[model samples]
Target: MSTADGPSDKNIGCAIYLHIPFCVSKCHYCDFASYAGKSHLLEPYLNALLTEIGSASVQENTRRIGSVYMGGGTPSTISPETAEKIMSAVAKKFNPSASSEKTIEANPESVTPERLAGYIKAGFNRLSIGVQSFNDRNLKSLGRAHDSQRALEAFDMARKAGFKNISVDLIYGIPGQTLSEFAEDISKAVSLAPEHISAYQLTVEEETPLWDMVEKGTVIMPEDTLLLEMFEKTVTSLSKAGYRHYEVSNFAKPGMECKHNLSYWLGEEFLGFGNGAHSFINSSRFANPDEPEDYIYEVDTAGRAGAEILGDEKDRVLEFLLMRLRLVGKKLTFKELDEKFFPFGRHDKHGPRPLFDETYRHPLDWISKNGLAEVNSDGFTLTHKGLLFLDDILLEFEKV
Candidate 1:
């Protein structure tokens, strides 16, 4: 609703997230706001998206646009020409810094040498390929259109296209995935030596196809112990391969952490465009319509979508803490918490009271005693074991 301003906004820039919600086919486990049979509406959606960017430009704030991320329903599904058009619109409106991290998410089957070249020419510097697994069976079970060979080829094509900053995404704990298979997948990803890798556990969301299969007993997920083993294997393998466990599920070569995503985890401002996209600015949040037709109509009639204020300052503090805790080696500094939030110390008139204060020292001490976390005079960081029980750790903070 309002522009972001504060001590924290000094030199920090806002990240831009553009959502492409059309997919060739839906994944079995995906519940995102993506449509499989919406190809015909792509043109209209793109036009409306351009208009939205133009509208935001008129009301531009002081925050410099530091990064632009094109995420999907398979952003690679679009033609390179169309992708270039979107980038052109962005460049015209925002004029992002030349050094900004521009990333586009692509699927293996949708990737081609020509498309990859087009992206590089359009000023994109980073490519994130969705290679969920290197096994064909795992691919089929997850409803991926590309197999192992295609994924491998996609990487080679990206490299040949002059993309130096590449990221590979993977999923573990599939219904039939074994720890050994996951290890092999990690091994393969390491061999490629992409700048970044994101390996997430399979979460069977409610009402998804995967959830139904689980409900019907048609597919049985691996046991919790096995999933933990898989997670351990991911961390150990990635670490040994010279990747830093920068976040819970993200690994990166030194100094190669994803800038756009890191901005989010650091509780910085971001503006999202296109249907089903979201924005957070000045302690308020906003969302565009999920449906293409609805979003187009709204942009045509209102120039912008509706805004929803998430909560008061307390909620933001909790959210910030929760998000910052996801950073593996990053500390939850009390100085930052105090500066951005409780400016008047713990006794601030406007207070949620910082979670790391003396009041919660008991639970913090217990966490330290169990070796799940390390709490110090400065702040706390989750031990590797603590990451495994992150939810449980968060519950301790929520209890206060």
Candidate 2:
């Protein structure tokens, strides 16, 4: 999991993403493409996915797909037979390596010893178990179907099934979760010694049950200040416990950063399948409708969804800023970036040389002045202080 150099001289090939849209139950704060009562649609949904994969093959020669990420709605909620069927379709459509970092997002309860075995047999080498919160009370509040113990058991099962690459998902900043409890959770988690941890601060989406509760005065979402405090605590605690804050919300044991996510940060191209799945190829991203019936029907009947390309260069520039700010110590080449991306006065810099652009204002000056980021012969990178303030700095990329 140490950084694999992804094409030093040039970038080519694409990533394949499959979204599994079935969850045993919905989380209170989730609005992802999923439904608890839609079990009846799995067969047709999967057929649609297969059709999409088949269609994707003819788009380009579809060479050397670097990774395969099966995200959820609890990808493991369905049987491993489902995983195999998807992989079988993928293999027919692309040249995915046996060693090509195959990953599946799993909820603890969905991962039994038998299912783990099936996953291994189906060619999944990596597993990211969603253990959202270590506190059982918070788990209930969040509507996680699996409890704390179940998450541990799932980890054991994943190990027994011969997965060397493993990651766990954790959530922080619950309505009443204390910092001490959060620390304890990390302490307990580090004892298990997973290679990766994606510790996310909860964000209540507008249409979620949690949002409705907040509207009814039944639930209280954290304030931005509180969320910032929680993120700070997480960085400190995880660092002390021997985890590196590789990305803004992701921590990892040395050499275990998630390569799939890294692709997103680096702005690489990828294709996706399944209901409500989205894709980015040659600088474009489009997602399918959330309705399973509609998505399935479209894919099965038409084999492709119409896509939206980022119309202007500004979108790509803004996207780059948003993505790179997530990494702790990585720099972009400004001169090269300007030559390739900016290429004009679209940025409306005050004067003289091309000092900046509208899409990326080059917070290099401000961040460096505040000791948050520094520029070298390359471009810039976040300092430790800057990493703590990364979100605020990233927001600066937006209009003032």
Which candidate number maximizes lDDT? 1
lDDT at 305 for candidate 2?
A: 62
Give one digit per residue, the lDDT tens place, for model 2 in 1-400: 4333221223324677898888888899898888888889888888888777878746543556878899978789879898998999888888687877789999997788999889888888899989887789989999889889898888888898888889988888888887777777777777788888888888778999999998999987767777677788888888888888778889888866777777777677777777677777655677777788888778766777645654566566667777766776555667657765756644545443453432344566677788987766556767778877766786666543
lDDT of 1: 0.85
Worst 10 residues of 1 by lDDT: 1-10
lDDT of 1 at 245: 83
* lDDT of each candidate versus the true structure: 0.85, 0.77
**In candidate 2, where is summed lDDT lowest over 10 consecutive residues?**
3-12
Candidate 1 wrongly placed segments (more than 4 Å):
1-12, 57-61, 346-363
